[model samples]
Target: MLATCLAQGTSGSPTVRVMSRDTQALLDTGSVVTLLRPVLAGGKAGEPMEVACVHGGTRTYDTCHVVIRTPHGVFTAQAGIVPNLPVPLLIGRDCPIFRPNKVWHVDGYDKLKPFGIAISGCIDGYSRRLMWLSSDSTNNNPAVIARYYLQCVSNCGVVPARLRTDCGTENGDMAAIQCSLREDHTDEFAGPLSHMYGTSTANQRIESWWSIFRKQRTQFWMDLFSDLRDRHYFNGTHEHKCLVWYVLLGIFQKELDEHRELWNNHTIRPVRQSLCPSGKPETMYHLPHRFGGRDCGFQVDPQVLQEFKDLLPPTNSLCGDDNLQYFANLERQSQLAPPINWPAAVDNYLTLKEMAGL
Candidate 1:
């Protein structure tokens, strides 16, 4: 006996096969339209529609409605017919199964440490634009992360419809602030719901960006630090770590700023499967309407933002005060100028290390 059920439609119509245990479905948030194979839609073609593909091109496909039964409930969804679809079903963001909430993804990268550096970043999910990318001694501090979020809001003159982050203690202050800011709003995603906590793996937008960041930027820094460790110049001592932070933090931040500029201005190639727009991130973010996207940012009053900023903890230094002062004194005594480049930074690091008897 066949494992799948075959249901008969009206007379002279092809039979529809119900989904079986072996059928595969993909939930793609990046896609704007749900899709189904012709076989799954009774082998009948509906009206024709032009859809964008991954290769910066468009393809015409038939459209139909399919009844999807899930453990949660059963619903009918409009789907395009793709003859060569790898999966039986593809669910996109436009489906009713997903909440229509706009969000910003926030996370930290600790991959650069021992050199005493951390990276905190936020990206607008709608445009995939980097809102802020900051390098510091530590990013796991709640106050520090909150400040970054608020600073971005202040600069942009708007707040995201929602904020999404991992369920880490480091996100506590940010979550609280988001809730406070939206407490009076009437939207479904306002109030406590304004901030969402999920695993880092599920934070797809920023997580995806991190891979690109590693390939384009962070790998070089990782290699540089590894080289220093291999040469025994960086012994991983607390004082030595502080020295590295003091000498290289500014340079690292400058590099991060440059990388942000390049990333925002560069053109993103089109992908056939993704429904998100492909263009310069800066343009897409500021002028979303050009690509059929609406700005999901909420305007907040500057005075209200200032009030929240006043509640945040004072900003912390990248390294210990004593260590920074000690290094400054050594530089003054040696009459060596502050580093303007990597070679100068290395020379100053070695000279200071030797002077401090490390």
Candidate 2:
């Protein structure tokens, strides 16, 4: 049966360069379905075919799926991997092998000019799997970044050996995060966490991802944000403002997750053959367990998340680290205080006055 491809080729779509073959392919969003006819590579008689069609399709496919087998990895036009399926292409060895819990790359991306909101995420340096995604109004600040990181590590179940970022304050003082710069001219420990604080080029893994993200998406940001603004929906009431923010966050988050899934499931095709092994990052992350792979050594404690959250300014408060303590105290007090039932309190006040000698 045909499954709709949300993040892949669409009919009448723009020409997109296929990362695997380095050739432009038609984005058939499924307007015209075609079955694979296994045939010779070229139009020559008595000549053996240099390439072959995968020879698999379902009745529901409205478009042709680009299928090919290569020495490095088997590829499907769709954005996913099927490990159990029999395929001719297999990376001879685990590509870009990782120590599993070693390092992570985190970054904030694309501050929308109209709304001033942006997306941030963390990806495994080894697996390249997107560990977390979020939208924030003040994404440039440490608090916002830290909150995202806390969610990331809380979900990842392990603390990385090191984390990298371009010396942006929004990266949050990683609880176990590597610092990107030194202050007061005093060199800090040159350990894993500290080592991550190098030049922007050093963080190419995450930086390159942001490039692909911008190219593939964000072109719609201005039009969508303008449409919302013209309607005056955000100008009417406080409720409207809050509702709009939540709505945008959800919308952006959904898109981010879809793109991330496509990136993670599809086999990573490096621009150069030697940059990485031709295989899916998810495969590298999970498949090792079956073949004498060492168990992940690092474990992140859930309680540690609260500590980092505490360091963040109040979500509603736009404050820097120097002012975080005061704002956090305010946040704590507000949480600790019970809600006042104003009507009952007024009635109690009236009774007390009546009972008095006055």
Candidate 3:
């Protein structure tokens, strides 16, 4: 059949046109079409309908709306009928999802602060021992705890995310947990509220609120107590006083200086140097001498000379003149050569007093 290219300006580009209405009718609706015209509510003639059609290649007819496979019921749609055209698209789950009704809102507390806190560090300090804090029903050890925190922090960054405590008991009672989950399931919070599973990204917004909470805690509780303790005015009820002070400090003033520094120097700064396409610049900084920092010079353990030799590249350990010369230069400069027996040499050259034997 012959066709004409119609330039539809609104939709853009060239639109093809067929020769006759009979061809358009055949393309729009096939034979054995079901009558969905009456089934659709508020649908009128000439309205666009969603026709679920199958062609003869897949089915018996050249193109038919009758669905062959139906587990629960038969599915059919009439030809040339418009589908449900809700003005605004509904943006929510269509299915009745079971969400355990458990909504848990977790806020961290760092014992000595007025503000809630969050930390990406292993709940238990991993460097000291591999122990983790056990708030969940799962078994926890130092390694597990450290790994858990490191994994969480590494995935979410050093900035703490909203922590989740499972609260599942060994008794197999999920009611209390479910209740807690539902109560905290607000629009701002997610948990059993929608089909969307819980993720760390959702808690990122609340990270900004941490500094404010920290400031309140620091000023009223820890800082005050720390100052008092340093001044030696701390009495028996110092802890109690700090707690009372925190409670009394009703107005909280956020620490803007540190937050501003972090934003300007770290958070918003652009990185220019990179080792590879994806390698990241070091984020954590430590004092060079006072604390452990990057070592510029190569250091080798004297006891591991054999292992070091094993680790050396073949070219580095080669018997060639160039390699030998390079190693000799390095040994002379670094003063790190093969072990020498200083005791035998020293024994021959006795001190004046020893030689005199007085």
Candidate 4:
């Protein structure tokens, strides 16, 4: 088995390391690596052994842990811990305590106890929900897509004077989004939605979003959710469900629907009273969706993304303290609006929309 690829051996597989006595602390220096016969000899002499084999004109390793048990004591001589099991073996290392074969019942089954049984299911109920929302929804509700998009926005940290979204009906209007310079500073968030790229492009962002989502949240959930199985970083956490609704809303124009709470108490920056009489009217501060660009009212031709290189500065050239701050704030915001009972949230939206008669 070790000679073929069907099983791996510490002798050479990249994933497995074969250690020497110095490394293992189990075997001694100059101690030979060998294999003991699995079956005992007819008399009290016990099993004969030889280290590693060159048989049929081929050098091969063993898959079993065959070792000698002398009257002095039994030691791991060869067949290092099922070598083909892909375990590392340090040569000359002192072998660990050994499990010896005892008297056995004629029936064979009379001895060992049964191993426990286990079960599993789709553990990441939340990630599964997000995947469902992203793949199923046509609205691209900012609420549903909130988790993924906001994470990126938070991660990127550039609160642009303008923002862009694919022309999906979901990002229809950046209802909740708003941006403005810290002061009458040079940068006014300005950028246009990429109307040319369709849902295919949307899916790409979705995939990337899943990658990050899994990285941040899955391991924690797996540690807690299932002892028998593992949870994926993306498909396994409840936060994924909560995050989906937020991303959905952000993608949809529904962001404006939620921003009301943020503005009532959200402090974007310190009031530069010297700059404005009323210490900077809170209403004046706006995000990209609130003003400017093709999504809001400006005429941005769809061709610009192809020539985006000419439109915006390179990342290193453009990034500065503010970009970092913006990213930090975005991450904070994700914490703020983690996923809620989304079905209820949607039902509330429908109820409100019906009341509004639009």
Identify the candidate with maximal TM-score.
Answer: 1
In candidate 1, what are the lDDT values of residues 256-340, reduced to their tens digit? 8998998889998765433456788899888877776567667889898889889888877756688899989998999998788
Model 4 per-residue lDDT tens digits across residues 1-358: 1111111122211121122111111211112232222231122232222232112123433334334443234444334332332223432212222111000000001000111111000000101112111221122333333333333234334322232233444343222332211123332222221111222222222333334334553343333324312323223232333232233333222332333233223333332111111111123222222222111122222333224223332222112345435433554644434325444434433333233232
Instruction: Estimate TM-scores for all models.
Output: 0.76, 0.50, 0.20, 0.18
Clash pairs, model 2 backbone: 2-60, 10-27, 10-28, 10-29, 11-28, 11-29, 33-62, 174-177
- Estimate candidate 1's alpha-carbon lDDT, on a 0 to 1 scale: 0.72
Q: Could you tell me how far off, in angstroms, the CA of residue 300 lies in candidate 2 after the best superposition?
A: 2.6
List per-candidate RMSD values in Å: 9.5, 15.4, 29.7, 26.4
**Which parts of model 3 have CA positions greater than 4 angstroms off?**
1-105, 111-208, 215-221, 235-358
All candidates' lDDT scores? 0.72, 0.44, 0.24, 0.26
| C-alpha lDDT of residue 112 in model 4 | 7
lDDT of 2 by residue, 68-147 (tens): 44322444432212222122111111222233444567776764624545677777655566777667655676766776
Which should have the higher lDDT, number 1 or number 2?
1
lDDT of 1 at 308: 84
Best model per lDDT: 1
